[model samples]
Target: MAETTLYDRGMATRRSVLGDAHVDNASAKMTEFDADFQQFITEGAWGSVWSRPGLTKRERSMITLALLAALGHDEEVAMHVRATANTGATPDDIKEALLHVAVYAGVPAANRAFKIAREELAKREGNGQ
Candidate 1:
């Protein structure tokens, strides 16, 4: 068997957290224009950082949610919220993170994130995810 590379490990971690369908859809839409950016996130974000053993994926997921919320990355926040099903971060975990975001990043940023998170949670609950 081939020795696993960073890209391979990243892909596995990405699929585990984000789900195969999302990964496959994103891969299917890949073109030369954004290929390097996609590879960078996989190798750096998923492989280098997320695959590290220091933090549970749940912790990482909450942290990601908080940062994304703080930065007002609404779509990314929603995506990550949906990913919590696999990461073991519950809705309460998301709430706590966003509450932290409110305290640190400001209420407006976290307020918008709360709306997005609630919508995503409802959708996830409906889907039984």
Candidate 2:
């Protein structure tokens, strides 16, 4: 497929997984300066890797949560935590992933991640989401 074609597919997948509100917000924030970067992520990260069929979306969600936590990407981690609902990742799944993070990514990171996840999960629960 052409690069633009692939990017369009990627953007669609990205919006479906991350939600249109979040994707629209991010798109609104993109300036001329960061446009390339945004496109890169849409085309590369979402299109190239995330679109692969090797893993279920649920598995991908778990891996994404663990990696984001390990990298201290709290905001992204929180976003993905919210995405758990769409991806069929349960609180139990998140708990198990966080336990893995605690072992490999360190207790501090896991602790902070757990707090963020709890908050997001509670908010979702409150909204009946």
Candidate 3:
């Protein structure tokens, strides 16, 4: 059998975690200028780190949400919040993580994250997720 490449592994992991529609949209919109950047994240972030067995996907999802919130990445925070559907990170789990973020990363960041998460969660529920 042929050895799986990082790109292949990354694509699979990313699609599983983020969902096929989102991945497909991102892939379809890739521009020549950003192609290398996308490939790098696929290989490094999704393939190398996310594929690690040390942490469960749920654990990683919590960490990712906290980090994104702490960094004031509102959009990414929402995106990952949606990803929780596949990662098994519950809304309560996210709330707990954001509580920690409030202490370590500032209340404002955590507050905004909570709002974004709420919006996404509502949408997910509305869709019968």
What does the lDDT come to for candidate 2?
0.93
Q: Can you give the TM-score per candidate against the true fold? A: 0.97, 0.94, 0.98
Which stretches of candidate 1 lie above 4 Å from their native place?
Answer: none
Winner on lDDT (2 vs 3): 3
lDDT of each: 0.96, 0.93, 0.97
User: Once superposed on the true structure, which residue ranges of model 2 sit more than 4 Å away at CA?
Assistant: 1-4
Q: Any residue pairs clashing in model 1, and if so which?
A: none
- Residue pairs with colliding backbones in model 2 are none
- Local accuracy of candidate 3 as per-residue lDDT tens digits, 50-118: 998999999999999999999999999999999999999999999999999999999999999999999
**For model 1, how does the per-residue alpha-carbon lDDT over 37-129 read when each residue is reduced to its tens digit?**
999999999999999998999999999999999999998999999999999999999999999999999999999999999998899878876
- The backbone clash count of each candidate, in order, is 0, 0, 0
What are the per-model C-alpha RMSD values against the true structure? 0.9, 1.8, 0.6
Backbone clashes in model 3, listed as residue pairs? none
Candidate 3 wrongly placed segments (more than 4 Å): none
Candidate 2: tens digits of C-alpha lDDT, residues 1-129: 545677987998898789999999999999999999999999998998888898988999999999999999999999999988878889999999999999998999999999999999999999988
